[model samples]
Target chain A: MRPALLFPLLGLTVALLFAGSLLTGPAAIGLGDSLAALFRGEGEAVVLVMREIRLPRALLGLMVGAALGASGAAMQGLLRNPLAEPGLIGTSAAAALGAVIALQTGLAAAFPPALPLLALAGAVVSVLAILGLAGPRGGSLTLILAGIAISALAAAFTALVLSLSPNPFAASEIVFWMMGSLADRSMLHVWIALPAMLAGALLLAGTGRGLDALTLGEDAAATLGLPVARLRLAVVLGVAALVGAATAVAGAVGFVGLVVPHLLRRAVGARPARLVPAAALGGAAVVLAADIAVRLIAPDRDLKLGVLTALVGAPFFLHLILKSRGERP
Target chain B: MTLLALDRLSVTRAGRPVLEGATLTIGAGEVVGLIGPNGAGKTTLLRAALGLIPAKGHASLAALPPARRARAAAFLPQQRDIAWPMPVAAVVALGRVAHAGSAGPADRAAVERALAAMGLADLAARPATELSGGEQARVLIARVLAQEAPLILADEPVAGLDPAQQIATMQVFAAHAAAGGAVLASLHDLGLAARHCTRLVMMQAGRIVADGPPAAVLTGAHLARVFGIRAQLSEGPDGPLFQTLGLL
Candidate 1:
């Protein structure tokens, strides 16, 4: 698809899925009632449900999906690897560990913003570590290896936090958190995640030209007058912020980054800079659609968002690996 | 005008000198070919001169700011890398990155001119990754051309090209020089270097052994000592023809 057509189509799809997410809930609220209560605040109970519950969920979906998608595109562009995403590179996992630490240590309970803030801190640390381990001129393989190591270490620490917890209820909540969901979230979560996500988007947005030049590899990009070091720094900080915020608010929503960019790469003609915005919209659509599916699949039981995304994304990941293998000698 | 000036440039890798005390200057309307045996510091010299790597000596281009450096000199690496399947035109348009803003008329014209020069006008809309290896080499060369910098530093620019394309590429570099620019290309093909370049700088083991006009630099002694090759050098109708007969 031409960019002119692709952007609008993706925007429309996101809008429809946003509506679907808002409308599809276990409360049995009608579409008209939901919209009226959401915007006009008409019905008392319905207004509470719409404004307090559904609206924030939908908004978080858009924000988280956009962050993941944009970060994924930026990562792929910087590293010149399609498989490079926040989750695979340990950004999300490190963020999750941060959130876990905040929860278990009662920091989140003491302060409302500590959850996402700590997660952002965690992301920054992990990203810095990845950069250090990967080195300045690290290859794709070195990056991935470093990421795998960081991810394992972070995941182990998170599990250690869970095991060392005295409160079994908090432990159970941590387990549920690990599964990831949008249930019972309020406007507070949205406000908490918003600033970091916006900051990340702003940073990643400036990297398009650099990423485009990087398609010719780092040495050529440097010769083309791009500040390659600055580009890497921005990408690192941006990915950390975005992934940390999203993981803090919505546990670990896996594969939205990987799957969305892969789906939209062709639509955007495989240009990394062009892929960022397109993938952002496409990611929002995919997540909203999946969020709606989770609600529809088990209206009463609360099906986790990660479960749905992984169900769809894991097979897609396999397909990508097989396809790439076929393409190689 | 001197487009590039390097004074006693030196590069060390892992505490060992890879390029040592290489001083050369390239002026406008000059196509200077850098020829040497493998690992003889030709690549290191070009990189050090362009300020792509940290080096010990002064390089005029290296002294400028990155943005100004890009406007002054464009470099083409030995490796041909097109990470995505972007259209050939899009890949070429990336050359205008340093110019800022979207692709304006001037940028578009430069891209079109580069495409036509490299005979890739028809492949403009095609995915660059889908082309044959030689065609991809041409596209990369076109991208370098699209940069429109006054000085071009190309490492093995014609390595993968066919004979005719190689000649055409050398002609393109020559044309760039004729248009008041300069090109310093590292090449292994001594014949092409001898015939097309206005001057040749030959290196042996981290040092320049000779630097002058092609006829003066491509001496039998330089060939034997630097490249370890016994070559026959004769004057063809077009220019000097250098043919390697056996190892020294």
Candidate 2:
């Protein structure tokens, strides 16, 4: 597909999904009335539900999904591995660990900013560790192996923190947070995550040309006149910032990044630079659609968004592995 | 004009010298072949001179900023793996990345000319990773050609190519030199090197042992001492003919 058509189509899908998400919920509100309540504030009760309840949820879904998608594409490009994702590479898990620490210790309750801040710190550390373990010239196997180790370590720490939590309520809250959902998120949460997400998006935006050069390999990329070290730094920080903020606000939504980029790769002609923005928009569409599905499938039960994404993504990942294995052998 | 100049360049890795005190200069309208044994540091020297690794002494191209250096020189590493399934045209277009603005007509024309040069115009829209090994090698060579830089540094460029393709690729580099560009390519194929390269530099154990015309550099003494082999060298209708007889 031509880029001119693909981007607009993706943008349209996200927009339609955004509208669908706004209309989806337990309270049955007509589309026109909801739009009026959201934009015009004509009705009190519907407006409250539209502006306060659904608006923030849809907005968070868009932001979280876009972050995951962009970061995943960047990570894959940086490591030259299609299987690389923030969730798979321990970045999201590390961020979750930090968020859990904040919640279990009541740091987040006392100081709300501590949550995303510590999560960002954890994300930065894990990304640095992964890059160190899997050097720039590392192959896919080494990269995935390092990611497995880091992910396992982060998960172990998270489990330990949960097991040792002194307050039973805090433990349950942390458990719910780990399930990854956009339910009950307010505009305040959106505001808190906005700065970091914007910063991350901006940083990732510039990495397209660098990532394109890197498709040839490290030495080749460097000789192409790319500052490979600086590009690596930007990718690491950008991915960390995006994952930290997304995990802080929405828990650990897995697979959006991986699945979105994979699906859109061919459409973008598999160019890493073009894949970034396409994946961003595609991610938003997937997340919004998933959020809408959660409401439709188990509206009263409050099914988590991560559960749905993993259900779809894990099988896709398996298919990818099988396909790649066939190609290799 | 001197396109690339290295002044006593040296590289040390893990407290051992991988490339030692090599001084050379490549001028426009020249194709210089770098020939050596497996561990004789031809790759290390090319990498160090391109500033892909740290080294003592000076590589004139390495001193410039990244953008300027990229515009001045293009490198094709021995590992010719394409990470993504990008189209061949898109991969070739990556060569234009160092240029400041978005791609323009000149960039498109360069890519077109490169594809034609590598005889890959028909495969421009094909996925690069789906091509065979030799085809992929040509695609990568086309990518380097698309850069339109003054100098190209290629490592073992003809290793996987068939004899005909190897000669054709050499002719491409020769054409680049004829158009006032330069190339410094590492090769194990002494025949190809002798025929295609205007000059030859032979290295032994991290040091350049010979640097001159093919006849002068690939002498019996240099071949025996550096490569541990005896080779026959004679003139042919096309160019210099080189053949390896037996190990010394």
Candidate 3:
């Protein structure tokens, strides 16, 4: 892509983000107050909201979005399938199940932590299971089938928990969370997932060349001296970590991971490596916009994050499916 | 040194036998054409040479076991789909995956040379999946060339190419042999085979019925027997010639 066009377009989206996060809410804190509180030099109620609560939430949204975006791109690339999205593979569903189980068992409360870790572990396990079921030499269909299996298994398990729940709110809350949300998230959630997601993202970044080779097909990739099986392993683990961490904290936020990467393929000149960064920025933008929309549109109802994304994303997803179908095989 | 050697090889897929007790050998710097009737196990043979399919056989490439044959021989399957809009250069680079630990300067040069040889230098930036059938065939061949292995096993390399592309692809295979590399390509074009191949192995059912220079193997009766097409064989200045008369 022309650097001039690409940079500014991406820069502008990121730039607009500052306003979406800051300008919303009844307080209506502007750039000045947000920046001041961001510096930790300001001492006021406005500063407190901007600095402590809102800032972390916004940063966390950025991290979650970036994680989803990068992991999604990597999954599509490694699988060599455009329809490949991290959420579709049941990583998020499995992670959400882990978080629910942790909470229900009270182990997470007793440990005062390990909830995100457990969630991440659950996601990785599901991914591995999918990989195993798909077989080492399996291509797009194999991965897709494996992913559906994981999603079904995880969703079923989560449903089982909800059915067994004594609290009426637990099932609905699980539903809302599975639908995805970023409301009432704390700095603690940020600290839990950010570092690990970031690490996985960087690992994915290093795999751009490998992913490029994968476009030719696995047999071709293997002939290039690349360990095709090993690449599959790395990509699966990366998806689990990033999506698991994000879902564990933010609930199973749908479509951002899927749509962000699809759009970024065009944004970053259609290169897989280029799509990674673009997807990251685009993911952050999409999530933050959805988050703000959720908050502003139904302040009383406190619309779930997942619900907002699905409402906005469902039509777009359908359009994409139709568009892809019309094109060549 | 021998580039590929298969002994007492048998291939079965889904409880059906494709090849049973098939034996073959290709020496370094030789271009061998595998000519077979439909269901004669041409693809199965090529695949077995690369160990892509499980077979009960003793296959060796450069004294290495069958499992590591990819490091010694490059394989190009008959049906190829890139699945993504990949750059041609990236597609070709997949040929070097077996050399992961030590990708030296030679690997890069081979990639460039392969692209240039296949006349894909200009199309390197384009998406591979978008290319036409002939272009994809060339690009895939370039990928195998980049593998830089001594033995090249290609299935139906000219299946979909125009006459010109068929000639050009044959020239590339000829060039590989000239450069002291081994090549084994399954071909239906008997004329091209007679012209370029150092040896020809003709198959009927799942076994080799004839193996020798093109002159001896592609006899008129042999074509009629295997292909169910009557033809006349005559010697030319260049090589053995076949003129198909009609369906048997």
TM-scores vs. true structure, each candidate: 0.96, 0.95, 0.86
Over A1-329, each residue of candidate 2 has an lDDT whose tens digit, in order, gives 98889999999999999999999999999988998999999899999999999999999999999999999999889889887786766788898998999999999999877877788778878888988997875555676787789889999999999999889999999998888999988888898789889999999998999999999998888888888888877887788788888998899898988888998999999999999999999999999999999999999998999999999889988998888799877
lDDT of candidate 1 over B1-248, digit per residue (tens): 99998999999899999988988989999999999989999888888887889998899999999999989999999989999999999998888887866389999999999999999999999989989999999999999999999999999999989999999999999999999999999999999999999999999899998999998998888888887888888988867898889997
lDDT for B197 (candidate 1): 97
Q: Give the TM-score of candidate 1.
A: 0.96
lDDT of 2: 0.90
DockQ for candidate 1: 0.88
DockQ for each model: 0.88, 0.86, 0.36
Show pairs that collide, candidate 1: none
> Can you write out model 3's per-residue Cα lDDT over A159-275, one digit (the tens) per residue?
788889887765565566566676666678888897778767767867766786676666555544456777777777777778888988887787787788887675454567667
Reference contacts reproduced by model 2: 0.90
Of the candidates numbered 1 and 3, which has the greater TM-score value? Answer: 1
Candidate 3 TM-score, C-alpha based: 0.86
Task: Compute the lDDT of residue A275 as modeled in candidate 1.
Answer: 94
Residue lDDT tens for model 2, B1-248: 99999999999999999889999999999999999999999999999988888899999987888889999999999999799999999999988887777399999999999999999999999999999999999999999999989999999998889888998999999999999999999999998899899999999889999999999999999999988999999998978899999997
lDDT on C-alpha atoms for all candidate structures: 0.89, 0.90, 0.78
Candidates 2 and 3, the one with greater DockQ: 2
Give the better candidate number (1 or 2) by lDDT.
2
